[model samples]
Target: MEVTQANILETLPQDMIVEILSRVGQNSSDQLLILKSVCKSFLKLSEDPLVLKRLSLDRWRLSPWGNPKLIYLFNLCTVFGNPNAIFCLGLIGYFDTKYTDLGLDFLKRASNSQLKEAVYVYGVIIFASHQIEAKHVGLQILNETFPPVPELVVAVRIKVFDLMRQLWLFNRHPFDDVAMPCPISDHDGYFPQFHGFEIAIPECMSCFWAYELDVFANRFAYN
Candidate 1:
């Protein structure tokens, strides 16, 4: 009967309530949990597919061996097509378990969602497969992040490098044995001449991107 925040929220339309909840916990699952505990209405609406899809598990460490409750939460998010959840599950499945195909499928899904990190890693993985058609598709995927301009390419490289670093910090093993797209033999005779010195530039765009992937993969590779 008294005016309260819960009362006000309850009076709002369901779409409005869902929109508000979607923004409530964009970065922290803990916030969502607390939100769900606030009221019965909140609890029921918190699991709405729209809310779940936008929820971020950023504050949570992703691990198959992690807390079962958290894992369940991740599963819920994944079911609703949360890109980050799909990426996390893909990494765990691809690296920690024997379900590599399933993991790749999830990664592809995440990539299709335009999650930049997913796009970068999935492209690199596919490129490293060494099959000609896969390499072409992979290169096309990688090219989506990198524009033709040199400056833009550098910017994407740095952004992707930072993303890879964050992933390595949380999920190291999966990145450990990633195959390099460019072999050592291909590296020779590809360097361009610059200021009377040999530069690391490759002869082709494909190799150049391959070099970028190799550098990133090696930079994060476990010792």
Candidate 2:
């Protein structure tokens, strides 16, 4: 007997099937959509809450001005509590004046879910505020996100940077105002500077990381 994919699926338990479907398409929505079209069972399994929550909508350019169908699909994932979806929705909400509060709520939920990108973005937004107490809380959140150990900090920063870059490209928007640098200076007296497209190193690691976040925020702000 020639064993087919459907045959394999039928032989496996439902939980195991869900795990397999969740892993398919490298978490890409496009690949998952293809899988869904293969048959009715695959289509039904694709919408399983577990599968939806695990789906990554990164490949889809999520924007109010973008593809409506894709946006709807992304929203469906968000309804299923997909962290990436929640994070993206938070960004969209944060940028729009009407949905700012709701956006922050989404971001907070994503951050609590241990989504590193959400934590970094949410922390930066709070840190960038004018309120001193908020800044302290933001700094604390950032500290927890990046960790104190040098090696771990480097690894987390690298991952966060890549995630930010992808997100920046995924949702590009234009703003009239340019992003201004934070007024806070380094405690070590090293002048904060920008080295063209790269983040300049400063004496204080905190200052350096904060500067990087400011730059990331600026990129999103300007375009």
Candidate 3:
């Protein structure tokens, strides 16, 4: 195409551009990266975390595209090292309704020796970030799948304790609300039944909270 033709194509509607990019993204090829770097609009779409995240994982049962999407996701987890990688791993189930069981499976698989520590820290972060939300989706996978993951859970709790101490000395009072970095700042703000203790990941769950735990069970077991 001539330079003028190329310039005209570049003026396509933003919506059309995004639509084309998403369609091309479905191809599972690195060529998408090249196109992204060629223009501002394409770069923005490509950088969307969800886009890269989905590209990094297997397409929901959309078999044989690249023939190694699972390995690709695992390799990505190893390379860039994002805790959310596991979450994205779990997100695949959302694409194909039939695979929702992978939610629980994702967490359970995370208990693999390699994934345990990440699970623990992330679990506490998720749980304590906000008890209401935390209680709904904490490390139920680690607890339910391993059922006896007290040591791992407790370790994460202790790490948070240490982190809190660090915050007190630096951020000065350390009681800032956050996923992590709140010092001595603990609250089961949502689940009082844990002995009136707001244990995030939990060394153990009391009988009273069993029903509350069901939230993750169904979501984990299904979505």
Candidate 4:
């Protein structure tokens, strides 16, 4: 009897195989690729919509969009009803001024699913838009009523507060709209520099203090 990788994978429960693939997709993209190349069963599992959804969300959090792999997977998984993939696709559109309306439509679908990240980003996109109606609608999404699920309230509040804090920090920056370099053009660099200062400031301040202390000590020392 000839044995094969597919045969071994086929012996496991389908959901169990999917769970393993999902975890692999979440943790290591390289390993997932290797697995996918090993056998038909592994490849199929790797392409599972749920696994792809997790991979897309991780990529969205870690990397800039429009990567071919992300776009392909996102488009395919979206057809399978992956709300996160839909949200990410909408985000790509929202970030581009020309597609703002289209982006809003995708975001609206994801928001209806109560995907917290989608809701928060949708609000940001709308608020940043030039259209008056968009701004009003975005604000409403940001401040949407807490759901009746008691267990979700705390998490939802934290996400909202985090977004609000980021917005507050953004508004506090000294530059006006015209003077500011467009963040959208360099979203990866600029967004974190300005909005993520809560985390960055502490680390940066410590380094600054260390440098200052060294300079002062050197200046005071006698030759």
Identify the leading candidate in terms of lDDT: 1
Q: Where in model 2 is the C-alpha error above 4 Å?
A: 1-3, 64-69, 147-186, 189-203
Query: What overall lDDT goes with each candidate model?
Result: 0.70, 0.66, 0.43, 0.54
Model 2 per-residue lDDT tens digits across residues 1-223: 9988777767667787678788873367778888787666777787788888888766655453476767666777888898888987787676644667898899998888778778877877777665668767877787777654434444555654554543433333322231424336525433445467444455454565556555555566433
Model 4 root-mean-square deviation: 14.1
* Residue range with the least summed lDDT across 10 consecutive positions in model 1: 189-198
Greater lDDT among 2 and 4 belongs to 2
User: What TM-score would each prediction reach against the true structure?
Assistant: 0.71, 0.70, 0.27, 0.47
Query: How do the residues 147-221 of candidate 1 rate in per-residue lDDT, one tens digit apiece?
Result: 544444555456545434434344344446555445435554223345453344445667676666566567665
Candidate with more favorable, higher TM-score: 2 or 4: 2
* Cα lDDT, model 2, residue 89: 76
Cα lDDT of model 3 overall?
A: 0.43
Clashing pairs in 2: none
